[model samples]
Target: MGDGRSGGGGANRPAWLQQYDLVGKIGEGTYGLVFLARTSHRKCCIAIKKFKQSKEGDGVSPTAIREIMLLRETCHENVVKLVNVHINHVDMSLYLAFDYAEYDLYEIIRHHREKLSHSINQYTVKSLLWQLLNGLNYLHSNWIIHRDLKPSNILVMGDGEEHGVVKIADFGLARIYQAPLKPLYENGVVVTIWYRAPELLLGAKHYTSAVDMWAVGCIFAELLTLKPLFQGVEAKATPNPFQLDQLDKIFKVLGHPTPEKWPTLVNLPYWQNDQQHIQGHKYDSHGLHNFVTVPQKSPAYDLLSKMLEYDPRKRITAAQALEHEYFRMDPLPGRNALVPSQPGEKIVNYPARPVDTTADFEGTVAVQPSQPVSSGNAASGNIAAASVAPSRSMPRSMHVVGMQRMPNAGISGPSAAAETKRSKYGNAESWLSSTEEALLRKPNGGHTCLFEIA
Candidate 1:
């Protein structure tokens, strides 16, 4: 149980956090460093987000507590699952565990920009966009506003074919909406600057889920363009940093913003004093290789334009976005093919966190070894008894065939004798635990793999 805190070199994870067998650091942020950990009983890998205690704070920060509370209250397929929470009594610090994923959307996009077959396809764009919106829909419906919505926060489940099971993670910045507030008018401030909605920039004091929608719009634009649509370089190292060309790039391609399209411009807290405005420029294919098509108005582009509306009011609802013709055109393929390092992967990295493998009955350890089940003795008229040998499929590792289980076959099957479908905890004579049955059984047509934990 390397709770991550220990003799300090980096941040010391307290010994109380040692319940998890720590693997390696997956990520770090202002608050806590993330670790990959596994539980003893369950071999499930979970992402553990350990909240760092602020020297100034009297106790766990209210923000961390709020995040845990909100995450526990909301759940959705598009949203990352909050597995559990651990509070160290010794230090009174808190840790949140979540389902581990292979990578985030940012990584996937960076790696497969040109490699993605659906780079410019309306079908693929629509599907991914729809998933993003669906997750947003769930959050907004619960009255939750995910203040930060960036590609990095949206994670891709695996590197396999089911690559786009995007889960919205990182709710530390989220705030519950009570009423709409005035939009911020600072132009290039708040949240992630590029994805920040106009209202936040305008200094809107009171806001609603629309803020998140605006960020969603930015993400959609990025997925299609590969490059961030509204990103401008910040003035290096100055608190007075400003994005002189905040809307320059956005307007340069999409055209100038007008009171007509965005009538609320005058109402923004930081509206320009000058009435002068810019007009749309001719579209250039500067960074739009496989990410976008040559023609801007392709179905995907049209859909993107709708999502990225400057006016939060005009921004499409996640549900409505899902219904858009794009998702209806081509349903995303099944998950088995898309997830790269699925349960089958030998050693997969998970977010460091503690998860209850017993709750799901899928003891953490993945099925790699064949268990020996005793069939009635050959002399006991059990000659007809047969068992399915376990199979290991590895793209990089050599394939090994299952060996004939003779009477002399030792309890632990040798690696050389690979079994395709052998029962776990070998020994059919060994009683099956409820957990094993649930995890190892074929639910419907697919073999179910529970989330791994340490």
Candidate 2:
């Protein structure tokens, strides 16, 4: 069996960990490393997110606690399911096991652009958008707001009963906005800079679910064009400075926001401070059709326009967007985003996510064996032979660095040079743009741990 233990063998490992075999390391972020593992009984693949101990020598990190709290209450096919929670009693590290998703929108988009040298099929795009909206609608209906909505966070199931289903993952920045004890703004900046809402960029203390819709609009555009709609360089500063470049990118295509367009525009903290730099710029309001390839009169364009409306109050709700005529048009959205609704349409086979066998579950580098360890079976044996001591303290502030993927061999795009320049801001990172040092800086007594299965 795969060795999940530390310096000692499997006998020294916790009882809860012995139930599964670590296949390989799949992803690594600010909080911890994610491993692909197989349950001993069912032999089904699962993603285990192992969070480092709190910096204060405390127990679990607040981000992990918050994710468990929010995910336990939510049950939907479109949302990623939290399977189990395990604790390494020896080190007090937290591990969250989730249903493994084999594909994400980022990889899929890159595949189409770099490998296939074509656009994603219209049916697949519609299905993905519809499913994303459906999941966001459920979250909104329950008063939750997924502050970070991006291509990498949107996951697609691999070969299984739920194949091609979209699962919205990552709940680190999610919060319940309904009847908050304190303004949601107190927690600091939220959402990745590229997909941030206009009101958020303008420093609006009081915001609504419309912010999520705006992100959905950006994702919809990316689904169509296979690129970030607003790929602007993020400003790295304390207290979350206003992202002028990001806002400028949005305004160039959608036009500058005015008090007439957004009634509450004058009340925002930044706008109220007489920011002459914002008012000095003038942009054409009808430039969206130029950026996105959709027909001006098409229902798809209408839905996108409504989602990207300058005023949050005027923005279309997820429930309302689902009923829009775009979905009602020819070749309706299907249940499976990867499968074609009509027969005889070629199915696009997306490559599985890459796994790094050299990285151990303990977030330490290990030597690769002479013969590669098989990822398919549990008894193939563990690769973590050498144990590297992990740091007890982690940085208080965390920023999610984008997971790098290997491009298909011998396949290059025509705009590879342009893409390389944009990759610095667009693909190299998935920033949270937080104002405070800690991700969840609030006092922790209010949230109860709900998903501690182990």
CA lDDT scores, all candidates in order: 0.52, 0.72
Residues 1-454 of candidate 1: C-alpha lDDT, one tens digit per residue: 4432321222244333445565445566767766555654566556778787545425455567667656655656678888767554344456788877655656545544654433433333454566677678766655567887887888755432333366789987775543232232322234677776665554554456777877877777776667677776655554422343555555555555567888876665445532343222333434332344435655556666677677778877765665565544433422221222234433322221222222111113322222211111223222221111224232221111231212212324322122311233232112223433332343332322123222
Off by over 4 Å in 1: 1-16, 89-92, 114-124, 159-164, 180-189, 235-242, 273-291, 331-454
- List model 2 lDDT by residue over 1-454, tens digit each: 3364422246655566777777677777767878877788887888888887666656556677667667776777888999887655455567889998878888889888899888898878888898898888777766678999999889987655676789999887886555423466876888888899989888888788899999999999998888888898888874763788898899988988889878899888777664676877677765789989799999999999999999999999987988888887766776567765565566666766666766666655556532222223223444221111122121121111231212322225324422432443231112222311233343442222224543
lDDT of 1 at 290: 34
Q: Report the CA-based lDDT of candidate 1 relative to the real structure.
A: 0.52
TM-score, per-candidate, Cα-based: 0.64, 0.80
RMSD of each: 18.1, 14.4
Residue 98 local lDDT, model 2: 93
Query: Please, what's the RMSD in Å of model 1?
Result: 18.1
Superposition error at 66 for model 1 (Å): 1.7
